[model samples]
Target: MKNLFFIPFLFLVTIASAQVQTGKASFYADKFDGHPTASGEKYRHNKLTGAHKSLPFGTKVKVTNLANNESVEVIINDRGPYVDGRIIDVSKSAAEKLGFINQGLADVKLEVVDPGDGKASDPGRPIEHVAVDENEFYEFEISRLKPKGYGIQIGTYQELVNLMRLADNLKSSYKKDVTVQVKVINGIKYYGLILGKFPSRPKAEQFREELKKKFPDAFIVEFNRL
Candidate 1:
C-alpha cells in the first residue's frame, strides 16, 4: 500500500512538470546589472536566470527558441516580462545562447523542470501577476487605471528589467510608490515607469519639475487609454 501511494504521487508530479507554455521571450537589459531581483539577489546579465509572470522563483525552466531551435535551461529568479503576450525574460547570457540577443525577442516554449519553494522571493517587489481569470495574468495598473490622474512618467523601455531597475531606484531614492505600466502599441511592447500618483495635475507637474533635474525627459502623464 505504501509503495502504491508513492508511485501515484510521483506520476502526478511528472504530469505537472511536463506542462508547457508557448509565447514570446526576451532578455534582460544591461542597465539592470547589480540591481536587486525578485529573488533578493543582485542581477547579473551573465547568470542563467529568468523572469516569469507567474512562475515561482528559483524554479528551473527549459526555454526553447522556436526560430533557431536553440534551448537553454534557466533558473527563475524574478517576476515579469509584464508586457502582454510575453511569457519569459531571460538573462543576457541565456539570450545569447538562445540566439535572440540581436533580435531582442523570440517566440519560445517554456517547461518547468523544478518547482521552487512557495515563498515571496522579494518582499519589496509587489506581487502583480496573479491569475484573475483562467489563461490570463491580471494586470493591476492596466485594469485599475484611472481616466484622469497625475503621474511622473520616467521613461519607456523595451526591456522589462530596465524599467524595473528605474522603478527600484526611484523607490530607493525618493521612498515613493513606483509603478510600471505595460502597453502594447503597434504590436510592440513598452514598459513605462511612473512614480508617485498624484490626484491633481498641478501637483504632478510640480513633482515632475523636481524629477526633471535628474531625469530630464521625465514628464507628467494623464492616464487616458491603454
Candidate 2:
C-alpha cells in the first residue's frame, strides 16, 4: 500500500523534471496586443507572460537568456511562436526584462516552475539558487563600452576562426571595413561580425539592405556606449 502511494509522487516528479527546454526565443510583435490567445486570455504586451507550444496555460516558467544570463519569470498564457526553431514567444515586457528587446531574438532556457495544476507549488525550490552574478553580465553590454551608433551585424559564431574567416571574406569581397566584437555569455564565447558604423539609423538601414543581397541574415544593430 505504501509503495502504491509512492508511485503517484514519483509520477509528479517525472513530470516536473521533464519540463525544461532550451531553444531560440522571440517576443510578440506589437500587433499582437489585445488579440485573443489560445488560452482565452487577451494578449498584453506589458504582461510578463509567454506562449509555449505544449506547456499547459498558467504554467509558470523561468526563462533565462543563455547569452546574457538574465532570467525572467513568466506565465505561459498562450500557444506558439509557430516560427520554425523557436521554443517560446515572450511578452514585450518580458523580452525587455531579459535584455533582448533590441536583438529581437535570443538563445534561452525555459524551466517549468509550476505545471498549472492549480495547486500551490513552490516554483523556486527545486532549482539551485545561485547568486545572481552580474560580473559576466556587464562584460557583454556593448552599449556600455562603445559609443552608441548603428551597424550591420552579419552573423554570430561560437568558433573564433569561423567568425574571423567570415569577417575576412566580407572585407575582401566588398572592400568594406569589418569589425569583430567578442562577447562571453554563460561562459560561452560569441564573435559577432559587424560592418561600418553609421551616424544615423537611416544610413544603417540603407547599408543593411545592400548587405542583405550578400548576407541574407544580416541585420541592423544599435550600439549605445555607456
Candidate 3:
C-alpha cells in the first residue's frame, strides 16, 4: 500500500468523514474479490461493506444512486475509492443495491448514518506495529543520530520501468536526490519515486520548480506519516 500519510482502516473514520463535504463515489465487482482491503481485511467483493476515503468503520451509511434514487445501507469497512475523483467504493452487493451493478460505478449521494452512541466493532488488531527496542545501547545510539529528512512520494504508477527511467534521469541531469520504491495496493504493484526531502514546503517547492522544468508532468505530493 502507499504508506504515505494514509490512515489505517476502520476506527478514526468519523474524523476522516468530516474533511470532505461532497464528492462522487463508486464500487468494485468480481474483479476485486479476495483482494486485501485498506483495513487489512481480505476484500470479499460480495460482502455488504464498503471502502470510503473517510467515514469510520462500522459507520452505517445510506448511499442513494443519483440516477435512480435507489438507496442501500452499508458499513464503512475499509479505506479508499483511491481512483481520482471518487468519494467511496462499494462492495458488489452494495453496488447492486444502489441499482448500478449492471452499469458498473454509479453517481451517488453518501450520507453518514450515525449509529446513535452505538459502539462499532474494532477491525481487529493491526497487522503491523512498531516495537521499541529495549537495548539500552541501541536506544542511546538512535537518540544521538540526527534524523534523516522526510521522503515525499512524487508519484506512483503500475509501471516499474517508467519509474526507474524517471529516477535515472533525475539522478543524471539534476543534482536533486531521488529514490524509487515499489508498493503493493490491493494486489496491484505500483512504483513510486521520491524527489528529495526538504524541511519546509517552500524548499520543497523550490525543488519542485527544477523538477517541473525536466519532468513537466511530475506532481508534488505530501507524504503523510503513518
Best by TM-score: 1
Query: Per-residue alpha-carbon lDDT of model 3 for 81-181, expressed as tens digits?
Result: 66666777888888877888777777777775432111123334342332211111100011111224444445554433233333443444455555444
Ranking by lDDT: 1, 2, 3
**All candidates: TM-score:** 0.49, 0.46, 0.43
**Global lDDT of each model?**
0.66, 0.64, 0.54
* Model 3 vs truth, CA RMSD: 18.0
Which regions in candidate 3 have their CA more than 4 angstroms from the true location?
1-21, 115-226
Q: What's the count of clashing pairs in each model shown?
A: 0, 3, 3
TM-score, ranked from best to worst: 1, 2, 3
Better of 2 and 3 by TM-score: 2
Query: Which structure among the candidates has the greatest lDDT?
Result: 1
Residue pairs with colliding backbones in model 1 are: none
**How many angstroms is residue 151 displaced in model 2 relative to the true structure, after the best TM-score fit?**
61
Which ranges in model 1 have alpha carbons more than 4 Å from their true place? 1-18, 119-126, 129-226
lDDT for each residue of candidate 1 in 91-124, tens digit (9 for 90 to 100): 9999999999889999999986544332344534
lDDT of 2 by residue, 1-226 (tens): 1110000000111222225778899999999999877666788999999987655456679999999999999987776777777889999999999999999999999986544321112222222222211111111112223435787877665534334334443554556656556666666566666777789999999988887755666888776631
Error of 1 at 90 (Å): 0.4
